[model samples]
Target: MAATEPAGSRHRNEAGPVGDQVRANLKFFRARQGISTTQLARLLEALGRPILATAITKIESGDRKVDVGDLVALALALRTTPNRMLLPDYGPSRGQADVALTPTVTVFPDLAWAWASGKQQLLAAEIALGHGEESPFEVLEEFRRNALTTAERQHADHTAVRAAEAVLSSIRGILDRIDNPVRYDVEDESRARHPDSAARLGPAPATPEGLRARLRSLIAEIDALIGDDSDG
Candidate 1:
């Protein structure tokens, strides 16, 4: 009990053969990776496990006893099997990282999953590779062209949106200025002729209908940019 736990409480799974078994399994994994305990702990943190380097040292030294869940977490972090962690002698034949590794365009470096990102990037890479045998640089060059085209299309769409917004803004400014035309022209004689001219013209109505028509026109221009040929 004291071997598993530091001092106060007894371990449910005491350290006799159980402790030796865990330690042996850990050693097997360590040998396979040639990874130091410190490095392993850092790798775990990188994999979001958050175990301290000191804690890993303790666990490896047989001073800190790990729970079953901890063992599972460690296995997952190391990208290995639970069976491999438990029975180190029966460990999977080396370099599993090499197995999962593949050439891909790293669009979002933070994203780890294969499916949920930049499908076009994956598709483009696959298409580039599928072409009749080419040199490595030639393959990459194909992907680069496709990537650039995709990026340019995205940029053009974004610019189209901004252009439409600018057009609407211009139309609004024109209509607003026309609605309450500022008579900056100083006309002393005209003021005298029309005594209460400010009161003569009641508040101007909003140009919602006219603005809506302009908005529809602007949308049609945008739709054309997006290639909405179905409306034809």
Candidate 2:
């Protein structure tokens, strides 16, 4: 029998369009960065996973295969992200061309870029291509639900942060007032405009003991907000 290829080796060697794109991008980015193959190899060596300059040249020439680790290393050496290296040129003029994702599957460059950049899912592309029997709306609704949940959580977190920042700003203003009570007449005028604010603000703490008490209360409020955020 002919000698068998090592397990997984054949797959690596036969990496198709995706691999070709990565190789092309590797060369593009390296040239843009004005780095030679020897320099890139040295950078990879410094990263502790050395690839020979000859191997880097072969990878750029599409004669050598790059595994995940090598892909990451090359990205770092080239000062670009792995997704950038994985995607074909997607300029406006080039966007009309289809990028071969596999031997059989090709997608528009923009769709390929979106998928590679994590802005959209491959399932969306499959649905767009009418490759599945499932209702597109139903499949997309599921993704929408997931995306909405993530967006809502992010919004909540941002709101909580803003609230905390406002509270901290109030505390800092209070401290400044304590430091120079006569300098902040604007605050007093505001307090006068909204008399109910004084009840929430409390009388400006006059002494060291009063300031300590105010700081303690503010710290407690911050802790409570943090606890609620963590629970959420």
Candidate 3:
């Protein structure tokens, strides 16, 4: 029989800083869902790893060492990605954390939800400033203004910051396309068919007689081409 790794050494990481982030996220998410330690343990057990309530308390209190397998299990039970549990760099870091507030973790779901909501608002703003609409430029200006206001002082969370950036980036693209339209030369069939004749005529005839002469010459040229084709 193979000897199993010691119980304490089974899943512990050499660098224990990862444990702090995981424990924090696990406690925070679990509390938000109003799940008791017993309930969480049962959920983890149901996910193919049996966990006892005491084990959960020890993990949260930093008494027990949490391993990679345990982190994956906890993340699954909490319905969040493992990165959210382990990575503390998901949000902007402000120097070193003090003892007052729990550091905010910018989970992926929150960012996704904020982006979807901002997209809907941007769509409405686009309709308000669409082509041929009254005061369309003003509408875009007002939208940009409101977004700036929100970005500057409205909120402090990472989701809020990312959402604001998304709106501004989208608005800038729309404005750029509007300002720089594609240009093309007007297609002139007369110029294409008879460049030499057009040059000789010198800027087209303004008078009725000149117009009639031009038309007659064009008709004669067409007739000659048709005659040659029939002969051939």
Candidate 4:
């Protein structure tokens, strides 16, 4: 459970600067929900807190101080979390320590899922390759599929996605060309002897470096997908 702060430390809800952010958040949420002060007051009353419509007006207009319980209650009535009602609007604070504001990183749900799935597929591919059970082309295909899914969901950069799609098409063509190539040829025997050493072997058709390059391209595409949800 979260430890509660002292009452005195709470945002002083008067007109100057103390509770400006909370007031703005409250007004924005209320107006966005099309809930008038009277309706909100009735909703709060239904929640067992009998606040008047005048009090709701004063609270939203930054003319009245809001208690901790009232803040939580108002947030619940607005159908939002308390933290959402308390987010700072990137404005100046009172005479306190100089605090630098940094951009908060947030991950999109679809991209996050694709990232986790890609990692699992990569680990499985590595294990399968070590056991000489699955073709490397099949692993690359899975990587391409994951990248395509993320690209479709990420509406940030269309050009990067198009390039990746073209590259994937080329890779699919190459994969189809050698769909049933012999796995244990004389050349492969020579390459297998130096399996542990990536340097001694020249660039083979299915070198790990080639796979790493594909992974890097996919990651670059994902990086280009950086933006906030509001942009959509």
The reply for model 1, stretches above 4 Å from the true place, is 1-13, 88-232
User: What digit string (tens of lDDT, one per residue) describes model 2 on residues 65-164?
Assistant: 9999998988888888888888877543422467888765677676676556433456645745676766667665554455446765465346445455
Ranking by TM-score: 2, 3, 4, 1
Best by TM-score: 2
lDDT (Cα, 0-100) at 141 in candidate 2: 51
Residues 1-232, model 1: lDDT tens digits: 3447557675465455545556677777777778877888887777767677788878878888877777877888667766555432411222222111133332222122222222123433455457557665675556445544676556635756646654565464445445434422244345556768834632122235445555666677778777677876
* Weakest ten-residue segment in model 3 by summed lDDT: 98-107
lDDT of each: 0.55, 0.71, 0.57, 0.59
Query: 49-92 in candidate 4: lDDT tens per residue?
Result: 77899988988766677778888888899998765565533222
Residue runs of model 3 more than 4 Å from their true location after superposition: 1-15, 89-232
Arranged by lDDT with the best first, the candidates are: 2, 4, 3, 1
After superposition, which runs of candidate 2 have C-alpha atoms over 4 Å from their true positions? 1-13, 94-96, 122-133, 141-232
Lowest lDDT sum, 10 consecutive residues, model 4, at 96-105
lDDT preference between candidates 1 and 4, better one: 4
As a whole number from 0 to 100, the lDDT of residue 102 in candidate 3 is 19
Query: What is the C-alpha local distance difference test score of candidate 1?
Result: 0.55
Q: Give the range where candidate 1 is weakest over 10 consecutive residues by summed lDDT.
A: 92-101
